[model samples]
Target: MTTPEPDSQVGIVLVSHSDALARETATLAGQFAGPHARIAAAGGTDDGGCGTSPDKVAAAIEQVDQGIGVLIIPDLGGSVLTARLFERPSAVVVADVPFVEGAIAAAVLAATGAPLPAVLQAADDARTYRKL
Candidate 1:
């Protein structure tokens, strides 16, 4: 079978307690990154389980991790556990940053081929947007 060409867009996953929050966060992140960026999201279901299970997260990473890398943005503490539970290929990177600004900045940077550390640093610096 012929292999599909790798995609250059960044892949993003959002894990949150609220599905709406996750989707909204992904949408806002897309806005920040513009239309060309590739983004995928997952969230917690009504029962409090992260909408994307460990297996599912791996699959999503595989799906999006073409030539570009996949970045995971988790909502809270447990969300980190969920991401950690999955073992992904080298094309995926999980950022230990908060879900809000962290995910957004990472998505934007990933779209531009920024290194994982640089992306994480940018996400960490995103706190500037939290002004009252």
Candidate 2:
């Protein structure tokens, strides 16, 4: 049996056009995400090309899902479309927020053991970030 905890666990899945960009962004977020942060990058085509693949996304979600829940962030329009195409488990949530910034916020909150809803809220809040 697992130990009972008060905080809700949530992981993040980043879907980007470029594999390197996705991994690099994940690394940047992981810096502040702490050890417990679960961030997965599902990018590029199945044949090692640039694009999002539903297969890759499903696999990424499976890898990151740690029994709590998952938040999906997509980089481009196609990436978002691909994320939407994949049939996810009930616990999956797709947040409409800036990909990089949202991932950073989500990673930080998730690292602190915040609940799934809280994490998604934080990511959604990232849309207000000042780009000026």
Which one is best on lDDT?
A: 2
lDDT tens digits, residue span 1-132, model 2: 532333546889999999988888888888877655789998899898999888889998888777788999899889988887753655788878998999999998887777788898999999999988
| Candidate 2 lDDT (Cα, 0 to 1) | 0.84
- Candidate 1 backbone clash number: 1
Tell me the TM-score of model 1.
0.75
lDDT at residue 3 of model 1 (Cα atoms):
27
Model 1: residues >4 Å from true position, as ranges? 1-7, 46-52, 87-90, 128-132
Quote the lDDT for 105 in model 1: 84
Clashing pairs in 2: none
| Residue-pair clash count for candidate 2 | 0
lDDT of 1 by residue, 17-116 (tens): 6667877998898788777556666676546664545654665566656564567777777767887665355556677676788878877876776655
